[model samples]
Target chain A: MDNLSMQKLLWGVFWITSLAIGMVVAGRLWHMRLLADVSVRSRVQQSLQLVAKREGWLISDMSIRSVTPDAVIIEHRQHMRGRDPRVCVRIPLGTLEILPCTS
Target chain B: MLLRVLVFGLLQGFAVLLAELHRYLGVHTDEAKYLLNIPYPHPPLMRWILETTDGWQHQEIFWRIVFASLLTQGTWFVWDMGRKLHKDQRVTLCGLWLFSGALLLQAGTLFMPTITAIETLFLCWILQRIEFLKRWSALIPLLWLEMLFVAYQGILFAPLIFVALRQSGIAPWQRWSAFLIPIGLLALYTPTNPLTIVATGSVSGMSMGMPLEESVARVLKLWVIGGSMALSVLGLYGMVKSKQYPLVLTLMLVTAYIFVGFRSFYAILFTPLLIAGLLSAPKLLKSSAFLLALQIAAGTAIFLYVPFPEYSSARSVGDALRVAGVHGDILIAGSFGHEWQYLMPGPVKRYRPDFTNDAAAIVCLDRCVAIDRQAWQRFPQTTEEVWVKIRD
Candidate 1:
């Protein structure tokens, strides 16, 4: 094939390959976001419950304020010493396994 | 037409301002270095400009304004270049939109030499295209000024300028003089040590001599994350189809820089050309607006959801040390220790293993914090710890 034709063929291949890769990446990111949306709140709640139980407090309410890959900030109302107050705690996901109840 | 361009510039400037605000609220190691005027590799022209303009005051508002202005100029130049190449206003507008939609704006927001270099490059390209230099002798001084201010990547474009001069029907001796004079003057009088500047080139966190697969994976990850996967793919396809050899060459050189451990910010330099190429692609022209919208949406989603590095922790730690009456000589020990060095209140000294004995405080992360628990007090709010020497 002539140089122009060869160049066109290579570009065609590149276009197809890039499109396929882009689709896969987009799909994976969307899937991850979906999973995070579904599971992150529940996970945060579980962690807060565990913390409350270990501290001998009643878990009145729990909510995840923010979710990051490495850390989650959870706001939970706990009844401690005859007082109920909302407390926000940042939990490092990496150290979750070493939490008092889990350990 | 002039009013429309002005509006576009205003929008681009506003976007840059937003990105700058985001940087201030989040982790920004390199930006801090530039603001603080910490010495590093590359020319000090960018830092000098920031300092002279009082960019360090008011939470770096002045710096942000300057950066936004330069970025607007860059966007305008890119649009003009696109118009020259494609001769279609719609296509040029799409190219500009693609660029304004991407994380390239985030790179432009930083107080870094890369953005300045990019703006200078565009100016050079524009000047060449316009035949602004009637005499070859005139380019020598211009070349010298560019070399002094533009980053190392700017050197790569020297040959292009040379080619332009040759094509302009300049006499052979005059062309050679234009090239040789800058080199001769730079070699004789440039204040910066060439060796030190070259050594500072490896700005990426990646270690040297990494495997080929790892390097390729790093580039791919950077493209996916930094450009938005859809836009990155489209941009690359566009470049290939457009057959813009200079754009391709620029992309390849940038990829090589990344492989050799330059930071991912370098990837953003390709955005203007990539956008131009994308707009030039025949298959993409029909759906250009739809694709541009998708890219903007994806870029926005990633920008909002992603957890960027928080340099605020380091600054807080630095504040804590200052409050505790610790001053002078801080030894930073960790993977990211160097990044936090600019947060030190005073002139930062190079980290030496022996300085651990005499330093006022030590800031360390991860394993360093774990190993030196007895000597270091763990800062409550951050992963890093401050080790204040107990002088009896």
Candidate 2:
């Protein structure tokens, strides 16, 4: 191969290598970050279960009222069938201590 | 000589000021994502740069300094670009000053895709103007790959490739191949660098067919934040008057951005052409110094007053964390948890119930996951509920 072709080959190789290395490094970093913790969804589910068990509500019947970064608010219907029968409980994150949520 | 010195001095001064203030700013959530190598949907090249350069650590202030340095050096490229395009020192000096005074001096220091895009645009311009691509036809593939990696948006400016190769005397087949090779290579890199993401984004961008009023508001913001309303208007006028490739390039960029999705930072790319137009009107040359002063004052005011909410919140949280001496399995929950992860002293993880431990401090940002308001030491900093576990 001529010098120009050789040069071209080297340039292509260098860039491809750089790109590959960069991508690999980025991927590895992402993988490490991913592995660092449990999935947020699973965590939220655990919180829900804890809240349900403590409140004497069936885990299946307890529906997620809202999900926030700090806590998941779970909604439960009281045994009393009346207007506005649904009651909401606050499961503050970290402690999972259920509290009465107003409004 | 005087104008050159003045422009350089102004650029350096603003660059230093930005670097100084950037130190106090909290690690923005976007910056955190990039630093931590979080798998964002956009192109990974910018993240790669951020992660590699910061040694795979959260060194936001250091990166800001580096960005500021690059912006200062970019002023030189802008000067040289003006000189090459206009072939007049006065035009070059005037354009340089105008560029130095623009809001870009502040925005360029940010750890965003804006700087990468601006740098890519500058390199593309330099390559074309120097006819470097024409001479080295083989380098086209490498350039394209680099452009794609650094700023996939660079693909939008592909007209420069044709302009570069237009009179290279290379056979039409070779010229066409030079331009076409990158598009083919893009497919090969698809597994790693997904062009589909760009396509998807573009399609979604189309779906977001903005109302005319909103579109006008955005354009107005682009002009004002880009540099100045007058400069953007003159830049448009100048491009039209020159009837050059720059005009076509400007139109392509503006149309793509406005119709596809508009961002004020994209103005960094347009400012150069605007400066070029400002220079074209020699009648405005006498008042150039006054314009520069006005722009400097304007940019400075924006820099000082513009309340970047993320940065402020980050700073406040970071300070509180530092004071609390937070460490060892820090659990960050809520929006911008990645940001807290970057600020934390030890292994910072997103809050998970299964992952909970007594030793771990749960930081609930924004609205704390319904934190027991009575028990946890609530650091009511910056209107966000910053909860740290005080007990087992």
Each prediction's whole-model lDDT (CA)? 0.52, 0.55
Minimum summed lDDT over a 10-residue window in model 1 chain B is located at B189-198
Among incorrect, acceptable, medium and high, the docking class of model 2 is: incorrect
**Per-candidate TM vs. native?**
0.59, 0.67
Q: What is candidate 1's CA lDDT for residue B244?
A: 59
Pairs with steric clashes in candidate 1: B27-B311
Residue-by-residue lDDT tens digits, candidate 2, B1-392: 99878867877776666777656655555566566544443455676676665443335666776677666656665565555343444443444434432344354245454564454546444553556544555555456556665554556657655655555456787567656655544443443322234444865485286687777676666555555555666656665676656545745665566545664445566555565555455454445556556656665565455455446365565566668776455555554445654565544544555444442456556344545545557665534555665654
Which residue segments of model 2 deviate by more than 4 Å?
A1-103, B1-10, B55-58, B84-108, B120-128, B131-141, B167-174, B185-210, B276-312, B346-355, B366-383, B389-392
Q: Can you give the DockQ of every candidate in the order shown?
A: 0.01, 0.03
Expressed as tens digits, the lDDT of each residue in B22-74 for candidate 1 is 55664366665455443444455575565454323354555665565565555
